[model samples]
Target: MSFSSFDRKKENSPQPSQWKLLRQELLKYLECFLMAVINGCQVSAPPNRTAAMWEDFITCLKHQDLVSSAALETQSCYLLTKTAVSRPLFLILDDNFYYQSMRYEVYQLARKYSLGFCQLFLDCSLETCLQRNGQRPQALPAETIHLMEGKIEKPNPEKNAWEHNSLIIPSTTCSSEASLKLTDLLLTALENPVTYIEDNVEQKKADRIICSTNVLHQADQMLRRIVSQTMKEAKDEQVLPFNLKLLAEELNKLKAEFLEDLKHGNKKYLCSQETVHIPDIISFFHYEKDNIVRKYFSKPH
Candidate 1:
């Protein structure tokens, strides 16, 4: 039977599918801009028709609260222009993109912007796809799936270096697991040399902050150890009750000086080395303690 006949016989139902839910989850997980061609199964159509479908999909996304209702022209321009500054972007095109010419255009765009590009092919068997399609409220005619199967082309790494990072996800996997797997794959792809350079700068800054915090913690420990030792020695000799107030004031001054030095110290030197020189830190504290001891003992009281 013809697809038109099949369509006429069935009631028009707009119930959402599992694929829709998966798409929503991906969008939320990425929290980034997206551009997709959301068309139902159809035979080959004119390029203009495809463009119209894209516009309709954008409208539907807004209605479903999936995206904002920003001006279409400005939004497209903004997404393209600020691709680097934005969190991340995902542009999903139909699997029917079999032509090398079409793939080349996409490759050029990714290359121009130094963006990582990966093609994810849903590798499902013909029977499996047909079975799933049969369960849909707006099921495509069996013949349509058959036609698509013949026309579909798998990604080739050697032939297309730009799309070398392609992934093939099997349809047999559970929906939730598949979504997670795809998420991980995309994250890994983001680390490709072409894209990692942009992300590495932020990572380096975070590392520096952690390293600086560790240095401050070490300084704090060194000061506390020195103060504790001095008080214990004074107590052993029963010397003026070990002057708790004086110990605290001296420790605070030493900490302030140490922190000042750390602030101006070579950050690269600190982070590259595995351990700070504990002996050097101890020596500095010992010198400070001697001055405190001398001044305290000199007082006649």
Candidate 2:
């Protein structure tokens, strides 16, 4: 199922936190709907507390001609199927998820149900996005697009392990190859959903050990940027394609090793506060990367 951001309109603009709350609520409804369908239920209804929000969301869908008017008369908020059959369901969430955190929320939801999770990042230019937005009958303000352009975060697999299943498709490159790649990505995700053992009360206490992962996440993003810049520099220096490939492999291996060390609480890299010394870690990474690059370039070609 898909929910378009443009279709959802409000008389008053919602603050960032309010928008977050609304998104969470809608996703909750989506989870409920999925559960109902999976259980072979005929009808799905919103909880009593958030019934009004569901009504508003349904109204928005109807206004956009996405749903039939007959849906309004139904006592059940949504009708999944007349007689549900036991079958796999593929859900596609199409939206402009500008923030990484926004997309991560959905990934978390998928993980909760052990469902497939993959995302397609439409790498469109701001100019093109604005042009298309203008062509719409109910066009959004140009300023809103500008604002979103500034806030948008494209998927970076190097930084986020969860986003590794994602594909970044340029706006102009919607070829058959891209379509096939997307199909493959979906199939792979379906075959291999996020796997993790459920945590009990005792295990939850040990969760504190992994709390530093949040810091590591930020560090990973920064480290990837550094590696990317370094590779670009190497390319500019006319590094051979063979050497470039080797360079990338070495850098990625180093990154994995570094991350593993951080995961295991390597005391050498931690500060007095038990937080990661990011600058020190980054410095060590740069040192290792530079050494690796030198080794690749020391000999001829």
Clashing residue pairs, backbone N/CA/C < 3 A, model 1:
none
List pairs with backbone clashes in candidate 2: none
Question: What C-alpha lDDT values do all the predictions have?
Answer: 0.53, 0.72
| Cα misplacement distance, residue 282 of candidate 1 (Å) | 90
TM-score of each: 0.38, 0.59
- What lDDT tens digits, residue by residue, belong to model 1 across residues 56-98? 4444444434455445545341112222224554545443454
The model with the greatest TM-score is 2
Query: On a 0 to 100 scale, what is the lDDT of residue 197 in model 1?
Result: 38
Residue-pair clashes, model 2? 0
For model 1, the run of ten residues with the poorest summed lDDT: 1-10
